[model samples]
Target: MPQRKIAIIGAGPGGLAAAMMLSAKGFQVQIFEKQDYVGGRTSSFTKQGYTFDLGPTFFSMPFILEEIFESSNRRLEDYVTLKKLDPMYTLSFDDLTIKASSDPEKMRQNIEKHFPGYGKNYDRFMNDTRKKMNALLPVLQNKHASLFDYLRLRSLKAIPQLEIGKSLHDVLSKYFDDERLKLSFTFQSKYLGMSPWDCPGAFSILSFMEHEYGVFHPAGGLNQLAKAMAEVVREHGGEIHTGTGVKKFILNGTRDISGLELDNGETIDVDDVVMNADFAQGMSQLVDDEKRRKYKNIKLQKKKYSCSTFMIYAGVNKPVDLDHHTILFSEDYKRNVEEITKSKIMSDDPSVYVQNASITDPSLAPEGKSSLYILAPVPNNFSGIDWHKEKTDFRDLVLDQVEKRAGLTDIRKNMEVEEILTPYEWEFDKHVYKGATFNLAHNLGQMMYFRPHNKLREMNRLWLVGGGTHPGSGLPTIFESAKITADLIARTYGVKEEKA
Candidate 1:
């Protein structure tokens, strides 16, 4: 029989991960990325001699990444050097600042230092949530193609611990009385681009994983993770075609995806096609509405989406005193969150996240200088705010907050160069649907079996992988989505895993 030719759309982390798995299994794999770069949002760029990660500054759960590399019979250390961040990040509230670390004793001390007598609360949270994490971890690792698949024994056993009807805020409130401490745990919901009050309780594990297992960073930048995966794909005989934009999928008789047509006017035939682009964006652009039963544009519009981000990359001529990561909460954080997620309006007092990587790794900036990555959450395109007009004002607001709250009071004056990316650019330039940078919201209705199945139900020989699909967003889960799809395809084709 001829080798199964698999065509993957986009060279994002998901696509690169899938490519590694398939090529290692002896299937012919070809990945088409619209940009000349390999990592999509996870890629990096350099300006004025300072480097910046396009998206995803830090990673949680190194084991998932390790498993992917192991699946290809390779070691992760060979590709990228990993470092565990000890004071993972600093959280700044109005009255106090707390440094979060994975060391239990240190974390307890920090909690007590800030919230006084809250050490017991941290202990209780860890003891209870660790069980939930173990229960849900295996479930996320598997494929949920149909309702029946999700009803299996493992999932059935884990159901109650899923925390069906509670919000993350509600869950954390059960332990901590102080609002700031509660906010410290709940703020991780932003990884899903969600407000804690709205993000599902099951997702509370997001913060637990960070405090328990720890967070990681690659030596050069987080984008190196993607670059390393791309390298593995090539080592295993896969081909990645960058600067290739897919126009649409070629279907036969309305059900089977035969191949893809590139925008450059080229057509390639293949046995299978995997979508690694944004779920809503890819479906609307590649598959015609007549063929889509579940995710037509109108229905997609109705589905809740994660909020977008307004990013600023600043290269400074002077060194700044800051941690590897810092989060400055807005004065009225809840209101700010509501404004972004519910009211669908820009917040004048937006929460800001700053990454001062130069202090940790000198390679990102020139000697005696530093770089800052500033991100402020904002409404996705659904807000209808004209970013083109608000861009300048928004940048000024973010910088002012950074200077005021982040302790970089003189940050603006030392700026040697800067770049800004608004939600509009995410939609128009990056082809993200609605500029929802984090993809679909993880609401109960849009999760698990209800989320887009790894195997596209409406069409054969087409699969989906990435933040837009099941197990729902974040780098670890995104990697799991790739593993799930790769496993499904491998089983279907009777392909055996190669021994290391």
Candidate 2:
């Protein structure tokens, strides 16, 4: 029999991963990425003896990723080395400094030292998060469903106990009474791209993963992981095509995906298709217009996209002594998110997240200098804002925060190369919906069965695997999404793909 031809659009971690897994299963897979390189939005850039991760600078859930490699009878260590960060991050706020550690006892001790009754509560929360994670991890590498998947977990019985109806803020308030502790606890929902007040109750899972899994970065920077992943794909006899545009999904009258057309007006039939493109943009721009109205009339509260960031990627002559990761939140945390969701413009006193990648991996910058990526989530372009005029204002505001928080007096003159990545760029360049990094917010109604499915409605042999798809965003989640999609395809085609 002719090998099943699978066409995956976008060579992101998800698409590349799906291609790698399926190609190993003896399915013919071709990955097309519009950009000249892979990693979609999560890719990197190298210039003048310095390297910078263009997006997503962290990785967690190593086992799930290793499972993908093991499927092809390969080892992740064989392709790349895993480094555990001793101090996950330093949380810097105007009134507080917190050391988030990978060590459980140290983490709990730190929390206890900062807030009374925090020690035991933190430990209990960690254990709970682990249980929730363990319950969820098995389903991570498989296809998704709504109540059915949770029903499969009738024994864990923590489903209702886990609270699927409350907001993250409501849950955190019930657990810890301290404001900073509450902020620390609820910050994990930032990964879901929603305000703690608006995120789903089950997103409490992030709290579990954060404390249990801890935060980490690859030694060679986040892109190092992507390079390793691509290497694995190439080793498995899969082919990747970059600098290619997919014109449209070619379909028959009944909505079966027959093939895909490229920007050059060429068509190739395929057995299956996976789209890693922005879900909203994909359906809006690529689908048949008449079919587009279906998603429009649905009345979904449009996933409250994560705050779009205004990032300053600068190379400086002197390295600041910050951790590999650090978050400098605004004094008024709730107000910052308000500007993002409601105001839709740059905030006056913005919350900044600064990463001195050069400190973690010296290889990221030149010998005498360091690379700094400073980010602050601002409103997406919702309230009729203009980026051209606001860019300078946002730049100055963030600089003021950096100067005060990092204790760095002067930076503009010492900078070697400065590149700004704003929400406008994200919308135009990467086509991110509302320029939001995590795709859709993991709100209560938008979580679980509420998130977009692997299969599009009224579309067959068509699938989606990315931040916009179910199982949500982040490197590990998207990578796991690829595995789940591959398994779904395997089951549908009856190919178990045993270790070869």
Candidate 3:
């Protein structure tokens, strides 16, 4: 039999996952990335004695990846180092300072301590959410099988009972009535660039994975996972060409894609193509005018895109008492979201997320020092805020907010070096689509099957993957999106799914 020839564009988690899986199944897979290295949104860089994940701070559903390697007769632990986060996160509001834990009992205890009578309610909510996750994760991790197919399975008893109708905001409200607890539980929606009020309740399964399955950080940094994934792609016989951005597809009037067109005007042939990019960019640019028009004319929310952070990766000379993840919010929570979504810029107060990796991963910095990535969400590029002036202003504003929030009066002086990432930087590189970081806001109409299909509507030999697809955003979800797209391709190409 002739070898299957396929091409995967965008070497992020999604693209790499698809390539590796198909290659293992005797497919000739080639991966093309625009940058000098793989790991699109998840890529990182080291500058001035500090390293940053560049994007995606938290890790969950790593088991989804473990299965990926297992199918290829490899072990994830042998290939990469992963550590469970203790006290998963530290979130600070004006009046509340919460230490979120991975242990369910410990979490219940903390809730009880912080909000009286929340323990039992939280326990029940967690139990139910875990059930939902049990049903959902497997579906996302392996493939995009028919929804009707899952309906026949017995374990998915939670399928119809999972309340897909209500928004996550309303679902949580029904269980825990406390304002702060509700705020904390639903904040995960932000990971999808969606507001809880409108994002589907099904996304709350993230609660089960992050809180129950737990969050992880690879040994060197989050980007270490990307490095390992690249290794897996190579080991499985996939070729990755970075700095070779795909400009478009070379399609024949037969309405079949022959291959891809490079930005430099070269064309590479392939039997099949998978795109792990901004779905719109792939359709509008890669596909010709005919097929691109078939995509659901999805409109982005006019509501301002999420704030693009002004990140300064700092190596502080002093060991600041920061956790692996520290989220310090501005005075008012509602105002913080409002300023970004409604007002569309840095408000009088802006929330901050600061990561001091050296606290746990000391290798990130020298002895007696800390390496920090400070992120302050500003308006995305489309918000009409000028970056030329606000860049310095926001950087200083971040330092001031940290000093006030942590009571570290001279935090800036302790900095050994700094590398900043402004919104413009994100737009220039990640195609983060106006710096929305999480891609095409996971709003109500753009979620689940409602999301852009893993298989393009009009194209026969083409498919889609990455943050913009069904499961939507976050590193793990992107990986799952790739797996679903691959499975769909396999089935369409006559590869029968393994039966139990």
In terms of lDDT, the best-performing candidate is 1
Q: Which candidate leads the pack in TM-score?
A: 1
Task: Report the Cα lDDT for candidate 1.
Answer: 0.92
Per-candidate local distance difference test: 0.92, 0.76, 0.75
User: After superposing candidate 1, which stretches have Cα over 4 Å from the reference?
Assistant: none
- List the candidate 3 regions with Cα displacement exceeding 4 Å: 138-165, 288-291, 296-307, 496-500
Model 1 agreement with the true structure over 205-324: per-residue lDDT tens digits: 999999989988798999999999999999988999999999999998888988889989999999999999999999999989988998888998999999999999999998879999
In order of lDDT, best first, we have 1, 2, 3
Consecutive 10-residue window with the lowest summed lDDT within model 1 = 143-152
Candidate 1 TM-score, true structure as reference: 0.99
lDDT of candidate 3 vs native? 0.75
What TM-score does candidate 2 reach?
0.94
Clashing pairs in 2: none
List TM-score per model, in order. 0.99, 0.94, 0.91
